[model samples]
Target chain A: MTQRLKTPLKEDDISSLKAGDEIILSGIIYGARDAAHKRIIESINSNQKLPFELKGSVIFYVGPSPVPPGRKSGAVGPTTSARMDSLTEPLLKKGLMGIIGKGDRNNHLRKLMQKYKCIYFIAPGGISAFLASKIKDIKEIAYNDLGPEAVFEIEVKDFPLFVAYDIQGNNIFELALRRE
Target chain B: MKIIKITKIKNQIKKLIKTASFNLPEDITDSIRQACSAEKNNTAKKILELILKNSEIAAKKKIPLCQDCGNVYIDIKIGENICIEKFSFLQDMADEAVAEAYKENYLRKSIVSDPLFDRINTKDNTPAYLSIVPADTLDGLEINVFLKGGGSENCSFLYMLTPSDSADAIISKVLDAVRQNVTKSCPPVIIGIGIGATSSKVTELARKAAFRNLKIRNADDKYKILENSILEKINNTGIGPAGLGGMTTALAVNIEYMPCHMATLPVAVSFACHSLRRASSKILLP
Candidate 1:
């Protein structure tokens, strides 16, 4: 059975999530990929305030297709998360609670996720249209110059993902490897 | 000798790009369906099923298969007897076709004007990498267009093996590359293994091999056997669909080889996710 969780993902919510658990994530989330992450980290290094708050919130690593005539998002799907690994540390340090993307994470970063009581979720890569259908709305929150890589506030309903890393640093990747 | 109008080439390219962006080629779709049935893990099976459904929706609704839509890569082979009429620059025409098609199809503009210094969206994906191959034959143009997503392309690798390296060393290297990077790209991946060439040519061969149709086998029987073996070993890694764990880590392994110097045995590996998008067509010159 899958777990249905909403936004404002608190510490308890993240702690309760186990690696390999399927989840239906709803409510507000922020979407940013490599370019936006770089800019955000630059801003952070400059000691400027972040555009979006991280506390109890979710970050989706995605660069969606252009919004078609009547759609909230176009073919939105997870990107390979490891690309943002270097920039991700600062964000996690600032109370970023959850991340939704695809593929594996570095071991050191998983430890940082645990230190911050955050979780990493994996959405199946390449099924963008199906994933897009679950999103209800999208608003560009920052870095509009980056276009698709810009930070956007997306409201989703029943967005499906797998909890690949939880607060305890139990990684589904390692578990899967061990099973093999 | 015959000629084809520039506008005809432009329109043909535009239509081909639109088709490739939204649809998986028939061979890849069929392969995915077969993988779904063969997948024992329930999660991986579901992921495979979703992939099939996504392709159907992408085609019917006219939405892109993936947001990345990728860098448009075109390979054109023009017969010497065939001439391009009205305009002569194939590269410019390829860019024009790409710009129009991306705008019309709602495909994401993934290209940056500059790789660094000042990164700006080109707005329309322009400047596709077009390689025009020369041939002396009938008056026809053969074009193959590909849309490879960024995630998988970033994981591609090239290695130059020493002359004395044994087959076991080559096998171990292939396996290591798969284990280290397979999860980074979306899987049941289609892997292209290019062997027996200098450094530069082997990478291109690998990129070409990865997108080659699953139904097409390496002509050499030995390479065909090696391809099957590599596929089996990759699946054994159990990276599964999207690396969640299962038996379908790679749907197929395509190999292409070239004759190279005795001292250099370069190998290149490129991966394409399940959204293997490619389209090909022939245009008869006027």
Candidate 2:
């Protein structure tokens, strides 16, 4: 069943989600990747204000292709989530409620999600053309030097995603592993 | 000896790059169709359907098949009787094509100028990685172009086995790797298993095999059988399309082997995700 949800979700909203539930997300979100993650961590360590507020925010790990003329974005698919695992818990602790990417993260990431009342969503990889149309508005937020890796504030409508990790630590990927 | 113009080759490169991004080869599309029909898992079937739809949209609009257009690799096979004219250095011409295509085609520029530090975007996707080979008794130049994303490249592995190891042992290692790391790359993968060579060359062969058309299998009958076996085992793991769980974790397995020393057996596994982007062209001369 396809469930529709608004972004900048609160704890209760994320807690209601369960692994394997499909969703269509609407509202504003942030797009970021490797370089942006590192910069965020550095900002936190140096005791500087984050460029964007993390509370009630969803971080999408995507370094989208350059937006072609007449289109909102180029192929904007999810990157591998595991690559950002090491730098993720801090964001979750800072009230980051959701993450959207592909692939399985580690037990530690699962535990963090459980502790923080967060959810991990898996956007299908390599389906950018369909997903790109969902973006209604966009602006470069930070790390312009990083180009595609730079952060972008984006508003989306009916963006397709599936719940991979839920608040209670259940992971859809782990469930897939067990159905032997 | 016959002559071919460098400008002609550059023009072909531009077309190859655009075609590789816009239109996935028919064999890969057919393989996806076969997997979708064979998949019993509902989630995997849906994922495969979405992938097919994405490709259809990309073809109609001339958009890139994936956002991560990936690093460009050019494999050139030149004939002994072919005389190249116009450009002094072929790599420069190929790089020019890459730059031009990425800009004009609206493809992503994903190349980093440096590896460890100072990770700057190259702006245009220049300095295409090249692999050149010389051919005998051929009359034209052939070029194979492919795009590889970091997600799939991260799952690639290389192993140096002792001479005494059996085929089953190698297969076991590959299965173990797939079970652990296949999700990182998009699933319904085409695995490239290269056996017998130095560490680097073995990996190279694996990459080459991964980019080859799904219609082509290993020439040797023994390797072909092993390829089938590996494909079956990987599918049984239940990774499925997009790793959502199903009977189609891997669509195909291609094994490439070479003659190596008696003391060592090197094996490399390079798998292509569902969007295995590649194209080829030939420059004929008179």
Candidate 3:
């Protein structure tokens, strides 16, 4: 059965989620990709303040297209999550609660999610237009110079996602492989 | 000889890029439809349905099918009887056309100035990967455009196998590649296998095969059978749509082969995700 959850997710909320559980997410989530992740890490290294609140937050790894005329968003789908595996620890260290992207991540990340009580959600890759329809609004929050890779606060309604990894260390990919 | 203006070619390239970004060719759509119907896993079926819906929305609204907009690959086949005005400037013309199309179409500019250091956005997607082929037997010019997404491109593989390797060896290698990479590349993907040739040439062959029309099978019966067998193995892995789990791991497997050195057998595997954005046009003359 599908469940609905709000952003800035808490431990209590995500702990109950098991791998392969479908969910709909509403509320504000942060949009960031490779470049933005690098800069965010640099800021942390330099002891500079983070651009956005990190506690109880979820980051969607995306570099959305230029918003077209008369539209709130352009094609906005998840990018591959594994690319961000090495850079994810700092965010999770600072209370980042969730990540949304496509594909399975490294085993280290799955363990980290379990350690931090975090969750990994997978959005269908390349279904950009239908995914865009879920976005209510988007505002650039930081790193505007990164262009499409800039961090943005995206307000979404009923954004569809699947639980790929949960707090208990269950992984949907492994489960799926076994089922097959 | 017929003379075609450079401006005409550039404009045509621009139009094809825009068309490809928004509309998927019918062969791709039809394959996805078939996969959707054949899918048994509910999650996989639902994902396939959403993919079809996304295609519809993208075409109807003239929005890009994916945010990557993709790095552009253009193949121009020129007939022996055709000559281009300012033929030396063909690459420049194609690059300009890409810049203009990406800007006016509201597509994302994903190209960077450098690969490793000082990675700066080029602002306009330029310097399209363009190739010119001599179509000696043809009567007119044909141009094909493929927009290859970054996610799928990352999944491409190249292997140097012993000359004595069997077909089963190649199939097993491809299966291993797909099993490891398909989740990130987006399945049900089309697998393109290139065997023989030098390493670089084999990779090029694989990319070309990946973008070939899905409706067309390899001309050689042996390669066609190999393609089918590989497809069956990949599907049996049950990677499913979007790699969540299901029966439809791949839509098609296209094999393009050439004679290779007696000492080495080079194999390359390329992937085209379900989107499979490509378009073609021809210039006819009287």
Candidate 4:
């Protein structure tokens, strides 16, 4: 069964999620990739003001293609979450509630997720075109110089995701592997 | 010698890129369908269905199969009797084709100018990884383009083993590699294994094996049996579709081998995500 989630994701929303629960997410989420993560961390470290509020926010690790002529997005899909593992803690520390990406994360990051009460969600990888159809709107919010890797405020409707890790440290990857 | 124009070649390349970007090859789709039926876990089965549906939407809507768009790899085979008209180098022609296709098709420009220090998007997705091979038996130029995304490429592995290592060792190593990195690449991947060349060449062989026609098995009976064995073992790992779990952890395992030094064995493994986007075209020489 699937649950519908509206952002900005709250403590209750994330806490209720379990590993392997399918979710259809709507409302606003932030788009950021490797370069954008670095800048966000640098700003936080320097005590500079961020362009968007991190608290109660969900960040998607992506570098979407240019918008097509008649579409809100062009092949927008989640990148591998493991690449963002090192840069995730600062955002979580600031009350970032959720992350959406593909693949597994490290145990260390899973522990950190539990401590911070953040949920790690996995979107289907390589299904970019289908994912893009769920995107309702997108606007660049910061670091425009990063091109495709820039930060954007994106609105999604019925974005499909599966919870890979929950606050209790339950992991969908391990459960799936041991299912048989 | 017959003369072929660079302009003609570039246009052919652009067509190949467009086709590959929008279409998921039939072999991959068929295998995924087979996996879906064979899947015992509900999560795995659902993921496979979604993959099939996504491909349908991509083709109908003219959307790129993946956002990565990927760094283009083109293997050009030129026949011995052909001469190019005003050709500087193959790379330049291929790059022009890539730039034009990516822009015209709305494919992402994912290439960076440099590897380390000055990481910057090239914007045009130029400088394709081109390998030009002389085709003595061919009557025309054949180009095969493969779009490989970053996630799967990151899972590629290389290992050096003593010559005495048994096939069991190879099997275990492959299982270990997949166990560690399978989910990272996207599950139900096509794995290419190269066992025998020197370190550098082995990976290339693995890449070629990975991207080679999925319908064709290795020519040697020995390697073919080995391929089937590895495939069974991998599926038995129960990593399943999308690593959420099931019986179809990998769609295929292809192994290419060459004779190497007696004292050392070099092995490489390369992966292609389920997308497995590729297209081929031939240029006629007049």
Q: In DockQ, how does model 2 score against the reference complex?
A: 0.76
DockQ of each: 0.83, 0.76, 0.82, 0.81
Comparing candidate 1 with candidate 4, which one achieves the higher lDDT? 4
> Model 4's DockQ?
0.81
Residue B166: error of model 2 in Å? 0.4
Per-residue CA lDDT of model 4 for B141-210, tens digit only, reads 9989999999899998999999889888889999999998888887889999999979998998999989
Q: Kindly list the per-residue Cα lDDT of model 1 for residues B36-97, writing each as its tens digit.
A: 89888888899999999999889888888888899999988888787777545878888999
| Top candidate by TM-score | 3
Per-residue error (Å), model 2, residue B227: 0.3
Candidate ranking (lDDT, best to worst): 3, 4, 1, 2
- Model 2 Cα lDDT, one tens digit per residue, B216-283: 88787888899989999998888787677899888899888889988999999997888888989887
TM-score (0 to 1) of chain B, per candidate? Answer: 0.96, 0.97, 0.98, 0.97
**Model 1: residues with Cα > 4 Å off, grouped in runs:** B86-88, B137-139
> After superposition, which runs of candidate 4 have C-alpha atoms over 4 Å from their true positions?
none
Compute the lDDT of residue B46 as modeled in candidate 3. Answer: 96
As for DockQ, the candidate ahead, 1 or 3, is 1
Off by over 4 Å in 3: none
| Preferred candidate (DockQ higher): 2 or 4 | 4
Every candidate's fraction of true contacts kept comes to 0.81, 0.70, 0.73, 0.75
lDDT of 1 by residue, A85-114 (tens): 778888987888999998897878888888
Top of the candidates by lDDT: 3
